[model samples]
Target: MDYIHLNEMEFYGYHGVFAEETKLGQRFRLTLSLAVDLKQAGETDELKQTVHYGEVYGLCKDVVEGEPKKLLEAVAEQLASRVMEDFPLIKGVRVLLVKPDPPIPGYYKSVAVELTRGIFV
Candidate 1:
């Protein structure tokens, strides 16, 4: 299998457990690794033979900005599901959703949720 990785994608979003957090919004970073068979594309040298990163990025942005969720787990799940649904060639994905500089009083730089989905090899 081959992999296409998109790392440290940062976006500003409104998602949190607190009402103020939701209203104020925060920055979220996403890192994703998509697993797929790239042999066909490598051999054929055709765009149609592989997953398009531009398309994937657009889909991810839509998912990120669409609505606010209370939990990062929920966001990760939805994003993973969407990736599978949108790109049939991908066998699976590893998603990391990070909340940087959260509105916490204590010393916390960020919080993150990492998830892997789809069938195992």
Candidate 2:
């Protein structure tokens, strides 16, 4: 199995439990790892033989920037589920969602949620 990784993809989104957060929005970073068998693509060098990363990025962007969700868990869940559903060749997906500046008063770098979905062989 081979993996395609998209790291630190940034976006602005209105996803939070607080009304102020939803109104103003915040920065989000997403890291996605998709597992697939790359043997066919490696041999044939055909676009159709493997997942198109551009399309995957577009899907992630749409989900991240489109709707207002209350939790990062929901966001991660949606992303993982969509990626698996949209690409049949993908055996699994791991999604990490990071919120750089959470509403908490504590001093910290960021809050993140990581989730994995689908079957791996």
Candidate 3:
């Protein structure tokens, strides 16, 4: 098994439970890992034989920057499901979503949610 990872991809979006949060918007970071068999691509040296990371990045960007969701879990879920559906070659996917500035009373760095989807075969 081989992994393709996109770490700390940033986006600005309106996604939160509070009305103020939705209106003001904030920065979010995402990390995505795709599991696949790289034997064919490595041997053949063909782009088509492996997952196209550029396309995967575009898909992640679209999910992060598209519709607003009340929870980071929803965002992560949607991204993982979409990736599995769109890229059938990928056996599994892991998504990590981070909100650098959460709407909270205390001083904290960030809040995050991690989700994994699909089956390994």
Candidate 4:
């Protein structure tokens, strides 16, 4: 299967269990991988035949920046669902949401959640 990857998307969002964390906000990075067959798009050479990456980006941005969720797992799951729902051609999708510089006691680089969804229902 052919795949398209969108990586290292950054967004400033207010999402945390702590009050200060929510009020101050932090940086989040999202990466998306979509698996699909591009036969129609390749043959026709038409934009409509393939998945609209711009739309996917916009939707991801909207979801990531829209609401404050305590867990990145929820964000990742929601993103996976939206991608599959919006793009019918995609056979599977993987979503990763990373939180950089989390407010933890020790030194930690980041925390993230990875989710995968298949198109078949």
lDDT of 2 by residue, 14-121 (tens): 999999889999999999999999999999999999999999999999999989899999999999999999999999999999999989899999999998887654
Best candidate according to lDDT: 2
Residue 27 displacement in candidate 4 (angstroms): 0.7
Better of 1 and 2 by lDDT: 2
lDDT of 1 by residue, 1-121 (tens): 6899998888888888998879988888999999999999999999999999989888888877779999999999999999999899999999999988677788877899999998535
TM-score of candidate 1 versus the correct structure, residues matched by position:
0.94
Weakest 10 consecutive residues, lDDT, candidate 1?
101-110
| Residues 1-121, model 3: lDDT tens digits | 7888898999988899999878999999999888999999999999989999989989988988889999999989999999999998999998989999998989888999998887643
Query: Sorted by TM-score, highest first, which candidate order results?
Result: 2, 3, 1, 4
Candidate 2: C-alpha lDDT = 0.94
Compose the digit string of candidate 4's lDDT tens values, residues 1-121: 8888899999988888888778998899999989988888999999988998989999998988879888888878888988999888899998889999788888778888887899522
- Pairs that clash in candidate 1: none
Q: Quantify all predictions' global Cα lDDT against the true fold.
A: 0.89, 0.94, 0.90, 0.87
lDDT of 4 at 93: 95
User: Which stretches of model 4 miss by more than 4 angstroms?
Assistant: 119-121
Best by TM-score: 2
